[model samples]
Target chain A: MIILIHGLMLIIIGIWAMLTRKNLIRIIIGFAIVDTGINLVLVAIGYIKGKTAPIINDAVSTAQGAAAGMQAVDKVVDPVPSALVLTAIVIGLAVTALMLAYAIRMHKTGRSLNIDDFEEQKW
Target chain B: MIETILTIVLAIISLMAAVYAVLTKKTLNAIIASGIISLLASIMFLLVSAPDVAMTEAAIGSGLTTVVFLYALKHIKDRRSTHDD
Candidate 1:
């Protein structure tokens, strides 16, 4: 429960940085922070108190090999959210890379990293 | 009990680092602070019993992301120096 709130706080801080920072790189850092926050929230949501991971290891069952799969479901936390977070992490990396590439190209063309200097792209 | 304490500490530190990252004037310092946030977050994931996410966050989030940002900064610096010449 606390972790969920912490994640939301982080997301807010990241958004604040993104909105206020003038440097393009600073904004990218903010985006990365937001990515981390979202991942944390997803994992926190799947976590059940007093439950182990969804992996069916020896802890879930020892002697009952045949019924282990059936028993493991109730013993572990949800796996779907973990899987979703894994995908999100990968996608976040790709997006960060793409953003950084754009920043580099923009700096090359505009000759500045300051957001305000890119007036030609603004409305 | 220990896990709870650890979680609280990690959360506080990561929050402080995030604030410092945004408020700091140096881009390099901000990058390092963001890396700190990622590293601490991976630890937080471990506390939540998500070891796989923890490992991935530590490796890609803290490791690769920081390296990429540093490289990008270097590239920008190099270009500026050359352009000035």
Candidate 2:
């Protein structure tokens, strides 16, 4: 419950940042915050109290050989969420870079970082 | 019991940094605060038993991202200065 709230609160703050901020780079920072918040929430969901990591080890009782690794399942936290977050983090970096590039080009053309300066269309 | 308390404390600190980063007027200050937010978050990830993710976050999120932002900000500043002269 506490973990969930922590993650959700960060997300809310990120959204607020993106909404209230005027600078293009600040908006990008807000986007990164949202990405981090989602990653935290996903990892929080995968945690199991008092359990070890998903690695097969002696403490997890793999004594029956590699084929009996299933026994370790109950003793460790989930790996799926961790893996997913890894991919998601990389994607977020790429997206942030792309956004920054766009901001750079906009600044070059307009001599301003304010998002409102780029507004030409009335839609 | 102790771990829970530590986590709660860390969470509050990071959240505050995030809020400050968003609300700060100066772009440089906002960027630095956001970097601190990522640094603190990586520490929290370590506490949560995700060392791999923590390392990745510290490397890409805090390190590379901040460097890129600094570069871009410097470029913008230089361009504006040259334009004035």
- Candidate 2 residue-pair clash tally: 0
lDDT of each: 0.92, 0.83
Error of 2 at A4 (Å): 2.1
Give me the displacement of residue B32 in model 2, in angstroms. 1.4
lDDT of 1 by residue, B19-46 (tens): 9999999999999999999999999888
**B1-85, model 2: which lDDT tens digit per residue?**
9988988888888888988888778989888887887887788777777777888989988998888888888888899899856
Candidate with best DockQ: 1
True contacts kept of each: 0.63, 0.48
Model 2 CA deviation exceeding 4 Å by range? A62-68
Cand. 2 TM to true fold:
0.93
